[model samples]
Target: MSSRQRLFTLMYRVGFAPWDGHPLPQALRDLVEGSAALPAGTALDLGCGTGDSSIYLAKHGWTVTGVDFVAKPLDRARAKAATARVVVEFERADVTRLSTEAVGSNFDLIVDSGCLHGMSAEDRDAYVREVAAVAAPQARLLIVAFIPGSSFGVPGIEPDEVKQRFARDWTLLSSGDETAMNHNGKNPARQYLFQRAV
Candidate 1:
């Protein structure tokens, strides 16, 4: 099975997910609320595990499309959206092979929370290209991932790696190391953010 399928199976077997945290990331909320008053035109949440970020964006007035390859997580995401009474379009698809036709159209903002870290180098390249293709010229991209100092099996991606992968098509908007207390309450991970070049 593909890595995406493996993730779905794992989540299906486990009754609860490790990453489903209450409340949106403070950093992301601050950025989205502070950037401008205009509602975002279109937004894509790639690898949107359980749709926390997607739901948050929708609540904040951005029309959101969440894509993940996992079925169980998508179900949970749909339920969460229904509970929150927000409208979101959720799809089951692999990010590595994502196409605009599949996503329906381009977007003005894209968020990937720890999605790219699990991908191999080649897949990461392709993922970036695909995302670029679906983003507008001035699109804002928010990415959150584990950095190298984190524990093993945590998909620890280095800052330099992010720079090398995204610099060609995106400009660094605001990036810094920040920790998030996981649902387990012991582990924390780093996050980074960027914006598509104008």
Candidate 2:
């Protein structure tokens, strides 16, 4: 396994996942709820640790599938879904190696909260291809990631990079600042919205 994969595995094993279990990001909530909500449809949550976002989508009337590389988080996610009285398919799979057989296809919406920013550049390229392979025409995608060279002091992605990478297959819909994530006060983040080109 890759070092990053091993780190994630170890984090989950020790219950040190600081990214799991929080209110859904406003950008995601706005897309699926309230006046401008998109219609209920098949949705995929990439790197769906503990499934909070996936459960939120399910409760909002979308058929949801949550994918995670770690096994322990998937267990918690399934239990959380059960407790919430929602059915969400939780799959243990790598986002860069997604396939129709691994997690189905033609998802109307795909969410990647704090996942893409952590990957190496090569993995990000694979991520873009894999996401498009499963997205339906005009499918909406929401990505919440730390902004590159921001106050977070961690490696992050830039908006231009996101747009440039998916330019051929997806169109930029919106890009805006996201609130601080975890205990990193004033951490600058950005949420990018895109739609698969028809």
Candidate 3:
């Protein structure tokens, strides 16, 4: 396994996953709740540790697939989804090397919370291409990532990088600071919403 994968596996084994169990981001919630909520559709949760967001989407009538690189989390996620009585397909796979044949495709919605920011530049490029390949035309994408230099000892991504990377395949819809995320409340985060270009 890659060092990053090993690190996450160890974290999950020790129950030190701070990224898990948090409430879904407001931007994500808006996609499924309230009057402005979107119609139920196929969704993909990248780096879906423990399947909270995947279960949320499934509970709202979506067909959800949750992917994580570590096997430990996939086991936990499957158990959680069973207890929640929501049918979410949990898979052990690297987001950077995702394949349509493995996870299926044409997802109408995609969510990445605390995932993309942790990847190397080459992995991020591969991730963008892999995601775009599976997204339906005009698919809505919500990404929550720590702002650059604010991820404590971990890597973070700048909003400019987010836009620049997705410029060709996605249209930037909106973005804002989400201060409640990250290891400490002091480090600022961001949520970017995009639509897949037709």
Please list the residue runs of candidate 3 whose C-alpha ends up more than 4 Å from where it truly belongs after superposition: 179-187
> Which 10-residue span in candidate 2 carries the lowest summed lDDT?
179-188
Candidate 3 TM-score over all chains jointly: 0.93
Alpha-carbon lDDT of model 1:
0.77
Give the runs in model 1 whose Cα sits over 4 Å from its true position: 35-38, 179-188
Winner on TM-score between 1 and 3 is 3
Encode model 1's per-residue lDDT on 1-198: one tens digit a residue.
Answer: 677568656866686455566446556776678665435678999888789999988998899999987788899899999999999999988787677448755688888877787777778888988888888888888787766656545566788888788899899877765545353654445556677886
Which digits, one per residue and each the tens of the lDDT, describe model 3 over residues 35-70? 788899999999999888998999999999999988
The local lDDT score (0 to 100) that residue 72 gets in candidate 2 is 92
- Candidate with more favorable, higher lDDT: 1 or 2: 2
Against the correct fold, how does model 1 do in TM-score?
Answer: 0.87
Report the Cα lDDT for residue 133, model 1: 83
Candidate 1, residue 149: lDDT: 56
lDDT of each: 0.77, 0.88, 0.88
lDDT of 3 at 132: 94
